[model samples]
Target: FEALHAAVAGLPVSGSRVLPGLVLRRDFAAYCPASGELAAVVVTESLHPALSAPGVEFVVGSEGQYQASLRWCTRRTEAVMKRLQSSNVKLLLSSVKQQEVVIYYAKLYGVSVVECLSSEEIALICEITGVSPCTPFGDNGEITETAVATFCQPLLLGSKRYVHVGFTSVCAFQPHCLILCGPVDGVNEQHAAALQGAFTMLQQLFKTVDQ
Candidate 1:
């Protein structure tokens, strides 16, 4: 709590800024049956904080490759997939071992499947980015395609655990949102300034608080 408070208070008044970004992937989608709409109750308790940041954005679409011939594409699906593959989509699709087949297929279409991070890594990403990290409190293994049904457990009539972090809720974590800091082209000056400022503020805050 003290650290969080300090980081915010010590934010740089002025300096070059570096935009920090985070990509969160979960295998929950693969846990559902191959066909039809399946439901799962992934606990968002951890992700609530990070997804709540200002400027944080969410894009939902196909996560894998686009092998379907252009002729087969419906305008709606095509439009949605385009958004999912946009340069702004930093967080990678998260899935478990069972979904490797689907993931492989997704890769064939140009999707970049990032291996699921462990709980600790997840925590680190959230802490460093000032986003709230959500961890599954239940014990489970990397899911496979066949066993994906296990992830679709129904929520009780009055329960809310099955809910996903709403789209609007996830996009709010902007200022602290992890900016994509990778070898990409066309990054603007404002992004660089944001990143630099975030780091500089953090450093100065640490020094002052240590005393």
Candidate 2:
């Protein structure tokens, strides 16, 4: 459990931490297998088709330009997925939403996807996993680095849904998550505050022990 410094982004990621172990509450995983596990995960921004942008400014009589651009974007996504497949990467994570075409190609390549992540979450992930937040995105985009995980699956905590993941890192701390179950937001917030105070006390206790 190294790097649990002051900036230890508690992140309520129901999110990312740079420590060896991380607590991630993923939005959702697509095309996840029955085992709910992925060998490696790559986090990136968006996977939208570049050709489909509204700002492309079509010609006065341009008939099939839009359709052609869409096709091109889709094809590029396919190529990117192919590269991932060849690299044995089984999971893709996106900080932003993914387009349908990107999802389709991912699934076709036998890769799973977790999308709609916040920037902080993405930063934590990159920090902990030692993976850069770069992937095949733009016309010149072409990085597909990955972080290995022991397990990746959906977790049901009360009525809310979360994703539980086991990351492999150099740190000795195995990250753990604590979920406060309360009917209302106010109660949960109170619980969070109490927990934070408790953790602070524990940290002090640990320092005393170290001394």
Candidate 3:
């Protein structure tokens, strides 16, 4: 990861821009079953500060104070809920993983989440989509709409735990290809050397095409 970050930092940009003009997020996975239905949810407004804040606590000396605080919290939650319900957004807030949350929101909001991505992956996606990646959260992070194309196929290697997941945003021109190999065990030296050779050849091919 450090090497990847350094490589991205070393990329040349114009006008004193040191960092590459790309958005790269790690440990963010948004995937849904291909056979499942997709729904659209547009968030027309930003969330309230009270609801968006990190933590909530109330110091109350009496029942009335406690009740008031509880009421306030309820009202805030209901406000957000009403907005989503009216907008036809599906809300999943119970014991859900981060990846699940991203998937749900993406499905509701008509967007796609690029997961387990490296810097190179990010650059490729941006080149394909012709749009900068949006942050999942923040002032500029709110996305209006995004389209994604997902491709999934089982390796059928007799291991259910190993699956290849990948996607790309819709674009006008042809996009680059990136395939990430999963971890394997009990590989001989010959196979390792062959794999390395294949990887190097692919890299050279990409460089040639780019040039």
Q: What is the C-alpha lDDT of each candidate?
A: 0.31, 0.63, 0.37
Model 1 Cα lDDT, one tens digit per residue, 1-211: 1111101112233422322232232333222222322211112232112212468664435433333322233332333223333422212323233134434333433433334445654343343334442232224321111101111222211211121211111235432223222222234334455656887899899999998
Residue 8, candidate 2: alpha-carbon lDDT: 18
Number of backbone clashes in candidate 2: 2
lDDT of 3 by residue, 81-149 (tens): 344434433322111123343355445543333344445544554455454543323454334433233
Which portions of model 2 show Cα errors greater than 4 Å? 1-23, 34-37, 52-61, 137-144, 204-211
Ranking by TM-score: 2, 3, 1
Candidate with the greatest TM-score versus the true structure: 2
Tens digits of per-residue lDDT for model 2 on 1-211? 1112211123343332232234455546575563543456555556654643566764534657766766777777788888778877777877777888878888788887888766776766666678887656645655546788777766555445655566776455455555444555565566667768888899999999999
Model 3, CA-based lDDT: 0.37
Best by lDDT: 2
RMSD of each: 18.6, 6.4, 12.0
TM-score of each: 0.24, 0.74, 0.36
Model 2: lDDT to the true structure: 0.63
lDDT of 1: 0.31
